[model samples]
Structures are given as structure tokens and as C-alpha cells.
Target: MDVSFLGGPHPQRGVGVVAPFDFALDRELWRWVPAEVSLHLTRTPFVPVEVSLDLARLVSEHETLGDAVRALNAVAPEVVAYACTSGSFVGGVAGEKAMREAMTRAGALPSLTTSGALLDALTELGARRIALVTPYTVSVTQSLEEYLAEAGITVTDRAFMGLTRHIWKVPYRDVADMARRAARGHADALFIS
Candidate 1:
């Protein structure tokens, strides 16, 4: 008698990521994911409309998210996560809930958004006061601040780059400096949004 063994990926051990068209930190996420798990990422359509409420509104549309989620659902991920912070918060708290629910329905699994994840992290850490740092313009940064405020987080200090384009082009050194400056004020933690 002869016997053979077949090996393949384990069930319910992979993660699905839905990113915005302009996202550039996929490598970072990949580097951090545990080797035992697989990462499946999909990008939603984006027009690169400067980082602002307008940009947020455009990217957070349910129609676009539905298409993106449908595409990711083909892989049958155990959990789906939306990786765009602005897109997740642009619609406010209710909008974030709706987006997560839509992804859950389309991907047929539990879903998470960047804003939701951030809030969870903050809550877990008991950090209600935050210093915000971002490469977005004042208007865009303000919108994010408002979203956090709705969640009961206070923005004690902030630093903005006021750049409307090429946020990914920013250097890491500059980002570090911005974060330091933003955290100068008394706060529980610094949030680089």
C-alpha cells in the first residue's frame, strides 16, 4: 500500500485588505503581518482629489466600496479591512459603521476600517487625548479632528503639512519631525493620521 500527502493553506488564517488607490504603505503592512498568515489586498478606484473633505467624500462612496469589496470577496478572506483613514472617517461615525457593514455583507465576513481600528486601539490604551499629525491641508486635517472628536477623543495639539498632492512623497525623517512637533503639547499619545 502507498500513501500520499497534500499540503495547502490553512482555512480561516488569511487577512483581506481594501486600500485606497493612493495608499503607498502596503509594504509596511506586509512587513508586520505574521508569517503564518497570508495577506490579500485590493485597491479601490480613486481620482487623487487633494486630501480634503472633497477627497474623503469621493473615496467613501458606497458604490465604489461595494465594487472594491466584491472584488476582494472573490478570495474569500476571513476578515476584510478597509485601510484608508480618510475614507473611513470622511462619513463620520455613522458612515464608518455603514462602510464596515457594507464590506461585511460584500466580503461575507467581519470587516474593519482604519478609523475604526484607530479608535479601538485608542480605547484599549485608554488614550482619550491625542496629538494629531498629518500631511494633509488644514481643511482635511480639521475633518479628521472632527471625526475623532465625535468619538470623544480630544486633539490637544496638531501639526499639518498643508500638502494637497503627493503625500506619499513625504520623507520619513520629515514625518518623524512632524510627529514630534505635534506631540509637544500635553497629550496621552500622538496620532499620525
Candidate 2:
């Protein structure tokens, strides 16, 4: 019965995540996180609208992001991340930067948005051209494309589901099929959004 020699529990680092109210991929997010780091997640306030440019605007408002960041600050996360593709890209590159700035202003923590992270990943991979698959309307997909273009990346081929809601409900087989179609022609990378 001698268990006193065991070491103390490791202190967990925290990462704050601000997700859209409709986001259903919390488990997916956790899959990439390490055991030593904890994710403190908050959702934007619910808005009565389908997934669209307007909904993206509402969820990614500076005030909403500030409030979410303030809430997450209570947990003292080392960094904060906004976890919405359309919301972060709807306004393009400038919008994504503004969201990160707003979150930092609210919590004084390093901040990033999904769109910004995607751009960073592309740059890191030296991927100048990519094929894209999205479960969003044409307009939303166009916004994402514009955002990528602003970062000097090109979408050589693309496919979309034209969906305004229930994006998570899309079957994997369909997504794979779309990816296969989109990945046609030469591309440095394949992006599924």
C-alpha cells in the first residue's frame, strides 16, 4: 500500500476555442490535441438563421468574439482560436485578421482564426495551388476562395455542396467523391472545408 512515491499530476496548458453555435466537431478538435493541453470551448450565441454569409457575419461579429474571448480568459488559456470557416473567411483576409485582433484585445492572448490557420498551413506546406471541396453555397465557397487568393494561394479546381445547413450531416462517401472530382488536374494540395 505504498503509493507515496508517485509524482504529482502534470499541469495542463489551456487553449480557448470559439466555435459557431452550430459547430458539431468538438470531438474532432480534441482528436488532434495532446493530453497535456486542454481545450476550453465556447460557442457563439445562437442566431435564427441558416448557414450563409449573413449567419457568418452574425456569429463572427467583433462584439461576439470579444465576449467569447473574455469568457475564455477566465480559464487563462495560452491562446484563443476562432473555429469557423465561413465566419472567418466571409469577410476575407482582412476580416480574419480583425477577428484575431479583436479576440486579443478582449483577452490579451494570442489569437487565430480558422481561415488564417488554413492560410498559414498552406504557406508552411509551400502549397501555392490547391483543389477545394466545401459543403457551402457558391457564394460562401467563393468567399473562401477569395480569402485564399488574398493570401496568394490559388484554387485550381473546386466543388461545393451548395448547402446552407446541416453540413455535418454530409456523408463521408459523398465528401470523398467530391474530393476525387475536385482533385482532378494539377494541384499542390487538396483542401476540404
Best-performing candidate as measured by TM-score? 2
Q: lDDT tens string, model 1, 1-193? A: 1223554544436788888788888887878887666788888786857677787778878878788888877777788888888889888889999999988877678999999999999999999999999888888788889899999999999998998777888899998999988898889989997
Per-model C-alpha lDDT, please?
0.85, 0.93
Once superposed on the true structure, which residue ranges of model 1 sit more than 4 Å away at CA?
1-12
* lDDT score for candidate 2 against the true structure: 0.93
Clashes of 1: 0
After superposing candidate 2 on the true structure, give the runs of residues whose Cα lies further than 4 Å from its correct spot.
Answer: 1-8
Q: How far out, in Å, is residue 123 in model 2?
A: 0.8
lDDT of 2 by residue, 1-193 (tens): 2233566666789999999999998988999999788999999999999989999999999999999999998999999999998999988888889999999999998999988899999989999999999999998899899889988999999999999889888899999999999999799999999
Candidate with the greatest lDDT versus the true structure:
2
Q: What are the TM-scores, per candidate, against the unseen true structure?
A: 0.91, 0.95
In model 2, the worst 10-residue window by lDDT is 1-10
